[model samples]
Target: MQKILVAGPTFPDVIERLKQYFEVDWNQGNALSGAELTQRLADKDGALTAGELINAAVLAAAPRLRVVSNMAVGFNNFDMGAFNAVNVLGTNTPDVLNESVADFGWALMMAAARRVVESEHWLRAGEWQKFQYDAFLGADIHGSTLGIVGMGRIGQALARRARGFNMRVVYHNRSRVAPQIEAELNAEYVSKEALLRIADHVVLVLPYTRENHHTIGAAELALMKSGATLTNIARGGIVDDAALAEALRAKRIGAAALDVFEGEPRVHPDLLAVPNVVLTPHIASATEATRRAMANLAADNLMAGLGEGPQAGHPPNPINPDVLGKARRS
Candidate 1:
C-alpha cells in the first residue's frame, strides 16, 4: 500500500477514510517544527498537511513524497517553486471558506471601527458608569469609502456586505477587475496608492507571496487617511505588523483589527500593547459549521489527490497541475 501521512491534528473521521485507502501515519499534534516535519515525510508518499513547512529541502529528503493536500486555503506555507521543481502536487480548500472568512472580515472591520472590543473590555472591568455623551466615539461604517486590497472571491463577498451600508467600494488588485464587475458591485478600480489615500476603511484579502510581503508597509500605511479603520482577514506578513503598531500608537489610523499576524501563532507584542487594535488568532473561517466544511473539503482533496475518492484522479485545487501529469487523470 502507498504510504500516506496526516501531518497534524485533523478530524478523526478524515483520517479513518484515508486509512481505508493508504498506509496512514498520523501525527496527532499541531504542525511539527521544520526539521521534525521533514523527518516525518521521509516515508510518506503523500500527506494531509496543515501548516507544515514543506520546501525544496524537505522534498529532496522525501523522494517518495508526491502530493500535499493542505487543510487550509492559504498554501503560502508550501514552497511552490520547490514543489514545481520536483513535480510534486499541492492543493488547498478554497471556495468552501470564502463566505465564512468574508463574514468575519466584515465583523472585524465593524469591531475595530466602532471600538466594540475595547468598550467591551472596559465594561467587563466593572467600570460601567452612566452613559457619557462622547464615550468611545467611533467611525461610522455606513456611507464610508471602503478599500479592498485584493479583489478575489472573499474580497467580493465583503463588497457585497457593504451594499446595505451604502459604502462605496474601491479596490486594488494585481490587475483590475472588469468594468462590469465594478459596476455590479458599485466599486471603483483604483491604484494601490489611491486606495490607501482616500478610503475611510481598508480591508486585506490578498494571498501571500514573495512579491506581496509587507504589501502594506510604512509607506502604504502613510498613505491611509488619518483616523481611518483597517482590518486584515488575509494571511500573516501581508502587512508590516511593527509599522501597524506604530500607526496605531500615533493614532495615525483610528483603529485596526487583525485575525492573522506575522510569525503567528505568536502575535506581535506591540499589537498587544495597543488597545485600539482588535486581535484574533487566525480564526476568520472558524465557525463550527464552516470549519467542519473546510475539514471535509480538505479531506476530499487528500482523498482525490491520493487517488481514492469520486474525484479519485482529479484533485480540484492543484497548485501545480502540471506536476501531477499522469497522476492527475489516472
Candidate 2:
C-alpha cells in the first residue's frame, strides 16, 4: 500500500478514506514542525497538510513525496517552484470556504466598527456603573464607503453584503473584474490610492505572495480616513503588524480587526497593547461545516493525485499543472 503522512489534524472521515488506499500515520491533533515535517516526509509518498509552510527545503528533504494536498483553499503555504521542480502534485480546497470566510470578515468589520470586543471586556470587568451617553461611540457603516483589497470571490461576496447597509463599494485588484460583474455587485474599480483615500471601512481579501507583502503598510495606512475602520480576512504578511499597531496607538486608523497576522499564534506584541484593534486566531473558515468540507476535499485531491478515484489523471486545481504530465509518465 502507498504510504501517506497525515501531518495535521483532520476530520475522522478523511482519515478513514485515506486508510482505504494508503497506510496513514495520522497526527490527529498536532501538525508537524518544519524539521519534523521534512523527516516524516522522507519516507511517505503523499502528505495532507493545512498551510504548514511546506517550502523548497521541505520538498528537497522529501524525495519520495509525490503529492501534497493542503486542507485549506490557500496554497500560499506551499512553495510552488520547488513542487514543480520535484514534480510533486499540489492541490487545495477552494470554493467551499469562500462564503463562510466572507461572512466572518463582515462580522469582524462590524465588531471593529461597533467596539464589540472592547465593550464586552469592559462589561466583564464590571465597569458598567452608569449608563453614559457617547460611551464606546463608533463610526457608522450605513452610507459609508466599503473598500476591498484583492477583490476575489470572498471580496465580491462582501460587496453584496454592503448593499443592504446602503454602502458604496470600491475595490483594488491586479485586473478589474468584468464590467458585468461590477454592475451585478454595484462595485466600482478604484486605484489602491483612491480606495485607501476614500473608504470609510477597508477590508482585505487577497492571497499572500512575496510581491504582496505589506500591501497595507505605513503609506497605505496614511491615506485612509483617520476614523476609518480596517478589516483583514486574508492571509498574514499582507499587512504590517507593527505598523498597524502603531497606527492604532496614534489613532491614525479608528479601529482594526484582524483574523490573520504576520507571525500567527505568536502575534506581534504591539497589537496586544492596543484598545482600538480586534484580533482573532485565524478562524474565518472555522465553522464546523466549512472545515469538514475543506478536509474532505483535501482527501479527494490526495486520492485523485495518487492516480485513483473518478478524478484519476486529473486532480482538481493543480497549482503546478506542468507536473501532471511528468508525474503520470514517472
Best candidate (score: TM-score):
2
TM-score for each predicted model, relative to the true structure: 0.96, 0.97
| lDDT (Cα, tens digit) per residue for candidate 1, span 109-148 | 9999999999999999999989899999999999899999
Worst 10 residues of 2 by lDDT: 321-330
Instruction: Return the lDDT, model 1, position 232.
Output: 93
Error of 1 at 183 (Å): 1.7
Colliding residue pairs in candidate 1 = none
Provide the lDDT at 68 for model 1. 92
Stretches of model 1 off by over 4 angstroms after superposition: 326-330
Colliding residue pairs in candidate 2: none
The candidate that achieves the highest lDDT relative to the unseen native structure: 2
lDDT of 2 by residue, 165-258 (tens): 9999999998999999999999999999999999999999998999999999999899999999999999899999999999999999999999
Q: How far does residue 7 in candidate 2 sit from its true spot (Å)? A: 0.9
- The per-prediction CA RMSD against the true structure, in angstroms, equals 2.1, 1.4
Backbone clashes, each candidate: 0, 0
